[model samples]
Target: MIQRAETEHSKELGCAKHLLLAIGSANVIGVSLPASLSSHAGPGAGQGRSVFFSDGVSRIRLTLDENSPVLIENSGETAVLTFDGPGGLISVEGFVEKTGCHCPKQAYITINEGCIFSCRYCNVPNLDKHIKTPDEIASLISDAVRRENVECISLTSGVVGTMQEEDERLFAILERVRPFGLPIGVSVYPTPGLSQRLFELGVSEVKFNLETATGKLFAEMCPSLDRDVLCNALKEAVGIFGKNRVYTNIILGLGESKAEMKQCITHCLENGVIPIIRPLTPSAQLSHFSRPLAEDILSISEFLQSELLRFGLDPSASKTMCAKCMGCDLTPMTDLHLGEVTP
Candidate 1:
């Protein structure tokens, strides 16, 4: 039987990781919440203007020409954030740099940042949003994959009007990228038939983020969403997308107990949906909450390993984004069983 307790090393690793994300490494660089980029939307981002950061093993290319919801600084060890313009530092909490990767294979793009409903923890609304034409999206994919390292595509978005509306917009961009023959992974709000629609569109993997786990917390954190509607959508999605192909997100440190989180994992496994677990990183918009206890996240991650493995899901084997990418989080259960790093 799997013990639900965290190991000493596991606890230390978890705490260190959480501290990095909960409060970005102040020793390396100091940063703050960035202002709006609307002031810098002068022209299209040009070539060779991208800034690069690395964790010694993997590297990333970022176009920091505009203001971002995240403020970044180099921890001088792992990853660093660089902006093309002035005032790169202000003040923000829970800003952990993404884990660096060598010759990255996944390219990430956002459809639009506009949202019809607002989740109190969401920071998307802090920035101006815009829609991209199919051709423009195609160009992004085209340029993104120019390196041999990039092998797949991942797209995320805020709801424009409704799930149906966002689906239509996503489909348009997928059509443009389909010709490239690269697998596409998408994370978005759950809507009726949205999973079926994506499967029909030939998407490789689908992620419907539930955000938080418990019904009471769901209602409290996401006031505009209906609990029943979201649950039904997950079930329906699994039925159509099949096991492992469907994924949902569970944000830790939102006042959810370990038992509540486990219940969610079991539910996802039972319904053929994979749980993409992540710890909460407090942003300027949601800075009121505290970072999760490192031991708690480690214990939870350790606990989920058996359940996830019992369900025949492996993080390293994941073909879609997050789990497979392992860039943002340090201890995604998907990456290993109990803080065991795999090469």
Candidate 2:
């Protein structure tokens, strides 16, 4: 019985492996693989070897063979898999950074539970909660920034009452935090004439997440949102914050195509907005979505790095550019190029 259970477990692992691969492929190519192929026979001898190239500098090799088991190797270490069968071949490269930003002491304060639009993937519970007092929110920001290296603060609130009321509360919070001179970022649902108001309040950056690339998907996923409103807000943000200051978060593994992804990136770039790509992690209360494979993440990162290079942006320049840049951009420049702002 033990042997039989082990065999069944191996099959289940195989199914999981294929499911991951299928989801990854579908995310990249925008098509689902057939169930039969997604659950094809287990990895056998000579059938599973994968190479990952990151930023054309780092290489990772993974090998899976019947008797040899699985072996994964990076620049400095090698890990051997003892149990699971071989997984298939996958390769990805681009967008490797040596370091990341120091996240500031930040807190997300949800003021209201009332949102005008309902998005399918949102994790927020109901939209009818009471608004937290501006003084309370401001106190939280002060405490966070006082702790350690907190250079920026992000303030996010729900849309409740009138648009003017939301604006008033947001402005009040900003007013209280302004004394610290710390950069502030906010997530706002696009409303007519709202971007300018937020920018005028000394918000360093604003995020109006597009969520999905295709309009059809947007309609399906965010039934209550008006796409045109969101687009206009993004456009206005570019005008207000300058292209480099405006950022949009894009979640991968939402059944978007590589072509669509590229198009979205290109659009954001031209408009002076940066695309912040992150994988979708499943939540028990939400949908059971799978994250894109490692290769896909690496590939998207690489593409972003290349594009940033074109714009004269280096990965190490400024963490204030979303806390990714440390103090590297502040050092004295012996031969600095004109029009380049380090950090």
TM-score, predicted candidate 2 vs. hidden true structure? 0.61
Worst 10 residues of 1 by lDDT: 39-48
Error of 2 at 277 (Å): 0.8
Off by over 4 Å in 1: 1-19, 25-104, 330-343
lDDT by residue for model 1 (21-107), tens = 333222223443222122111011111123333343322223343333233464433333321212222222223333111114566
lDDT of 2 by residue, 219-268 (tens): 87777777777777898887887746676667666778878877887777
Candidate 2 wrong stretches, greater than 4 Å: 1-104, 113-116, 126-130, 284-286, 311-343
Cα displacement (angstroms), candidate 2, residue 307, comes to 2.4
**Candidate maximizing lDDT:** 1
